[model samples]
Target: MPLRLPPLPALRFFEAAGRHQSFKLAAAELNVTPSAISHGIVGLEEALGVELFVREPRGISLTATGADYLSYVSEAFSLIAIGTQRLPNHRADRPIALSCAPTFASRWLLPRLAGFRARWPTVNVSVDTSHRQVGFPVDGFDFAIRMSRAPVAGTAWTRLFGERFVPVCSPAYLATLRDERGALSLQRATLIHVNAASEDWQAWLDATGADAIETSGGLRVDTIQLAFEAASMGLGVALGRKPLVDSDLASGALVEACAQTVAAGTAYWLVSAEQADSAIRRPELADFKRWLVDEAARFDADVAVADAVADTVPDGHVETNR
Candidate 1:
């Protein structure tokens, strides 16, 4: 017997609209007009002989029956996605395209990607270092890592880690800033700044109660990576963001100018497009996500251990010059 069902397109429209509870957002996700979403959903409701949504002047709300039906529709789509992915022709070598910030790609992900390659030798990962926030699936990106205080809209995300800022500079630069008491002073120190993080220095100063320090003049750079390089070269002190600067600190290329660390009130998140099938078709994507989460956890644990050790040491007034 033939399966009885509503129009597939109409069902899709209903699912999107119900998921977002806004025709406008659903339209954006599907790359259709809001009017089209409204009309399609209306057709779906008519075919089902039930009112799926309560239309309001400001927005839409799913009815009880609509919510119940949506779960089944969503489940069916998931099953279809799983089956499609399991098809014999689906190549294991298909690449996972990722979008992220240039600084993150260079300073963090690239260095650790070798571990991912070892785990999934057949899977290829492509990195696109674009500042622009690309829409998932539509933009042809498998995942994106973004820095934000909160998760980006219309995407599922995992919080990787929070950011903290500290003053960092070359050993020679730090030595030059030291007074007769062997204490570091920022009064005459050059404050290197990043254009994107203009307020970082000021924020750090506020946190450390170093309001007396002059922040008016400094060498400005386009990215945090450049700022780090300048600091390492003894040009000036830069407010280095953690994780990005972790390698530099570990390598002794840069040292903290002060013991104080200020939270940036932001964090890096791993994001993927909000879709029913997200990563279901790509087992590699799942593996990549697991690996990323584990790596983040390990970093956090290492930081925790270091902080514990530092707590046992006597606090000193002397700060690193280099």
Candidate 2:
């Protein structure tokens, strides 16, 4: 269908001038010269075959026709602006889709996600659980949180934090060990083994000189988070990541079954393709990136404080026994 309408620029100039009651003010608002606004209004009035504004020696005032036309034009512009605002949120609802390991998502990211939401109310996020690293851009994911020894190829990576592996057990299980003399031994206690994190348990055992304890002989879990849950339920001791267990320890739901901690070599990373060509239209990715980095920084700082507290423990403290 052929649509007949006045030139858009002319309508804009008339609406602005009518709203302000002065061409000079309309020019300033539109970032145009007053002469331009005046010409546009003149062209518009000629097309409409009516005077929109009556120019006076002092300034200008809208005529009856201009005032009536303005009511409609102003409403149209307001509607356009409101519609534009809702578009980004429609895109935001898809969320900045991320692929991450189930254990890390459950133990670390999920626990602190509320803070991310508070800071970025409009940027939605969804986490995909997989031990396998998904191909970036190819998989169409906006980001991936991974525990990796090295960054995946074709993607830029930012290290979030390294992990320290330590043995953790429920408070009930720890109560059974308070009476043990010298080094606390877990020889008889059931050990929780996560197939994916066997190395962490092996590292902790090696560091604590508990070489005789069989790490392979225990209930095997598929994920580290489940292992922590098992340990928290007084099922057995689980090799836990320090950052993941911080809240549990603080809440007295879990405690250090052993003081020995070993660096797990792998670290958590935020990764994405270097070029944002795939999902650049989703501006929420940038907001999520900045927020994740800020949250990671705060997490590292909190871990540092915990480390300091552990170091400054008094001689009679429970940690001193290890």
Candidate 3:
């Protein structure tokens, strides 16, 4: 049988040494220590049962086998790199990479992304969603959106929107309550609670002064998006993040049964960097920002309208259910 090559990692080391002709140079090129390069090449040579290089005081030189192998190795690595660079664009001709919080990605941002895709038919977007606070340069994120209470310390942070949280459920659930004061009946509904936050129904009850409910029963989820999902499915009433669950509310998947909103102590922001903010030069980011600001203004107007409705309505008619 012909000789089977060693594994990829070992082959790569031998290939580096064959071209550069010095294990030291190969080590430097690969960002590995010299001993690592030596060990890797030794493994490769043992596997191949052939000596491919010669070391001399002057320097290292390639044997006939080494010279021949270098050509194939170089070509292989070049093709591999080209293949890697093209992976993100596999679905399209062009690509734009974006990063954001996973929950925001699943809920609000994703819903709006179709419009961007429709408008820019050629630009494919790859989303990287995570909750770990990722820095721009260190993390290699192109553009990102983040939700937070405090301003980010070292970046060009653009205020996207501030949102309040409210108790929401299917309107059918609300209609069943006998006493309006018991509406925050954490005891009755599945109080779909978000996990990342420190509090649950117990904390919510304490904060809102809703003393009647048990505040102990409910399924807990890791993200606001999941809470909204449960609420939409009628699994429970969720303390909904307004930005995330607004679509659900509008679609009647869920309804805002209470007018009381507990400030979530956080807001969402569009973020990039001072340098990478140049991505905004593409005009897509700017357009999105404009539309988003308009939407937030509309939401604020709705809040004002709700306040007006509450103020004008008589105390008896103001149904205290929410």
Candidate 4:
């Protein structure tokens, strides 16, 4: 038996009208006259033997049956679009869209993008900074890098790296904290805070058993990059996440304020499009996933080396800059 369906044009008109809740608006969207939309809907209702919309003096509204039908129609459109987008003619030059946390994009991912471009010259990458978790496919994002302790449902999650929070400050500022006892104490020093990473400071204090020091008073920066910059300028001490601070720490811009770090247990996760089939069908997306995992692994290896080196330092021995 042949597939029983309303006319394609009628279905389109009804779907548009139901979405906008106005025949006039649907006509404008479909580039047709309001009378045409009305005729299409009439034909659709006759075909289905059901009244889809309640015509009103001001505008049209979906009937109970129409509202239910609209959901299936909209979802069908989305699936059709997804299938079309995965066709071979979709082309490779299309940019891979990724949404990530601002600090991760700035301090970690942006620097390494040149390497990504070097490896995948034909593939372009677009980055959108956001803290909000994205819904893939519907949100039109190929991937999202979210900071969380666990994987998100309905997406492929690849663990990046767990957070290591450490107290960092400028050498000049550290000098100001030193008393006649030749010991540095944060009790008298101002703390720098990031509104988003506020828990870092408390975690550090809790882990180090330095609860006596007041962590409440400080300049609050909105992003991790800004907090790190503020700390490097001798403004105050900031609890820095290792991934964002590793380069600055290695270059002497920011020094460890104490020989203590708190394992935050939270990690960066690369979330692919909701469907595994999407990645398998789109080579560019697969390439992006592979590249991101490789970069994260390289970062973890580097951090491991740094941790080993720091371990070699004798206990309670803090390096002082002359």
Candidate 5:
């Protein structure tokens, strides 16, 4: 006994035609002529003894049977794609390309990427730091980290972490801003601003209810990294983003100028192309995704514990000699 089926090429043409609802479009996608698509679908109908398309003067559409059959065909192709990707030696040497914002790449990812390399030394990774939105597969990126308030359309994404902004400055710079009673005064302080996050100061002010402070003036820089450097050099106070500034804060290179942290209303997300059958199937991509997500989870857990401890401490409580 043998399996009965239409020609594979005919089925391929039929699936593409059914999906696009136009022979011209399907032909373009398959890099063939419209006549080839029409003939192929006709041959497929003749072989199956059933019409799969309703041809009209303007265009073509899937028949009821065609619509149902398309579902099966699409699923079959998807399974084939998944299976093909699982094959050994399937692009194992290809490096995993990633795209993300420059600030995030420098401040957050680069610091932690060594851990990933240590874990999966065989998988090479190339990172592109660009703020421009990229088209999947076309841009040649297997993964991306994006900061956004809403999900990007036509992609699968996982929330990395929400952002919180706080004022930070070098210890020496902060010392100049404190008054006799040890209260911070911002009236005479120079505000450092990042052009990419122009509204950060205003947002922070509104969240803290500091109506007297004006945000019209500042040492504006194009990048958050530069602004941080300027602040670390004791130039002024920079609005620091968590996780990015975590290392600096821990090292005592930068300290909170004030005690307020405000939600940024946006979060970091790990994104991959919506049609990611091939990329997602790769072991290297899978390992990298898992490692990145686990790292973010651990950071979140640590932040939660620190917040819990901070909440328990009474406000304005100071330690003194007994």
Candidate 6:
């Protein structure tokens, strides 16, 4: 029997918009426009003879019909996988499809991956680096590490760690800081900035409350890992995350330019949805999450150690001890 369905283009648009709740954002993801998504949804609803979304002032929401239809679509995709598709090779036997933020993956998870492998030698982990929420039905991803200000609703979520941004550079950069406030210090050096740190320098200014020199000029990088790399290579001071550079600072690859660091007003979480129960489900995800929480606990300990170390020494001590 020949089967017929609405065009996948329309379904894809609706799926993205429904999941994100903003056609504008969905458009960004789809590389389309708000009007295009609205048109596509209109076409889809007309084809089905029912509206899939309730248009709202600020954004769209699932209507009762929309929500019910979504559940069916979600299950249909799952059935497709279970009924015919091959699962991602078993994590215990192959790579677990792990998703994470690029910076977090590079600076944090990669450093600890070997340990995850050592603990479960049979388990292999593959990482995806995008700063967006990926759900299970579309892709067979086993788990995702998401940076969210709030817990990811409708998923199993665990608090990973909150972030704090601090200015970091090579020890050689700070050697020139002959003054207590590091005054006349960074002005001579370029200040590399990253998009994630839009508020970082501003917050540091608040923390230090100084106007001695402008610390806002240097090589601009699009990615945090690149910024850290530049900072390590003597390019300029980079604002870095606590977990990302804790190892670097301890190893002296990078040194703090300013003693004060401020919170980034966001956090990260490890999430798995209900579809996580598929046969492709790997025990290693649970294991990895437990390991991550413990790792975060150690970072918390490091923060405490850093604070105590900072208190014992004065603000402009500049010795840069762990």
lDDT of each: 0.81, 0.77, 0.66, 0.81, 0.82, 0.74
* Candidate 2 C-alpha RMSD relative to the actual structure: 22.3
Model 3 ranges with Cα > 4 A deviation? 1-94, 114-124, 179-187, 200-208, 211-217, 232-234, 275-322
Which scores better on lDDT, 3 or 4? 4
Clash count list over all predictions: 4, 0, 1, 0, 0, 2
lDDT by residue (199-318, candidate 6, tens digit) is: 666566566554554655568878778888899998888887887888789899998887667777778887776544553354666777788789878877787777778668767543
Model 4 lDDT tens row, 176-206: 8876777677776788988876877887777
Which is the better candidate, 1 or 4, if ranked by TM-score?
A: 4
- Which ranges in model 5 have alpha carbons more than 4 Å from their true place? 1-92, 314-322
Candidate 6 deviant stretches above 4 angstroms? 1-5, 16-94, 130-132, 175-190, 211-219, 233-235, 250-253, 278-282, 317-322
TM-scores, all models, native as reference: 0.69, 0.64, 0.56, 0.72, 0.68, 0.69
lDDT of 3 by residue, 56-146 (tens): 8888788898888877776666556445534645333334556788877777767777766686666666788744444443234446777
Select the stronger candidate by lDDT from 4 and 6: 4
RMSD of each: 8.3, 22.3, 14.2, 9.1, 11.0, 6.2
State the TM-score for model 1.
Answer: 0.69
Clashing pairs in 1: 170-322, 171-322, 174-321, 175-321
lDDT of 5 by residue, 159-276 (tens): 9888788889999998888667776677657899988779889898888777677688879999888988999999998999987888889999999887577879889999986766
Better of 3 and 5 by TM-score: 5
C-alpha-based local distance difference test score of model 5: 0.82
Model 4 spans > 4 angstroms off = 1-81, 87-92, 317-322
| Predicted structure 6: lDDT | 0.74
Please report, as a residue range, the 10-residue window in candidate 2 with the lowest summed lDDT: 313-322
Candidate that scores best on TM-score: 4
Q: Could you tell me which 10 consecutive residues in candidate 3 have the lowest summed lDDT?
A: 313-322
Ranking by TM-score: 4, 1, 6, 5, 2, 3
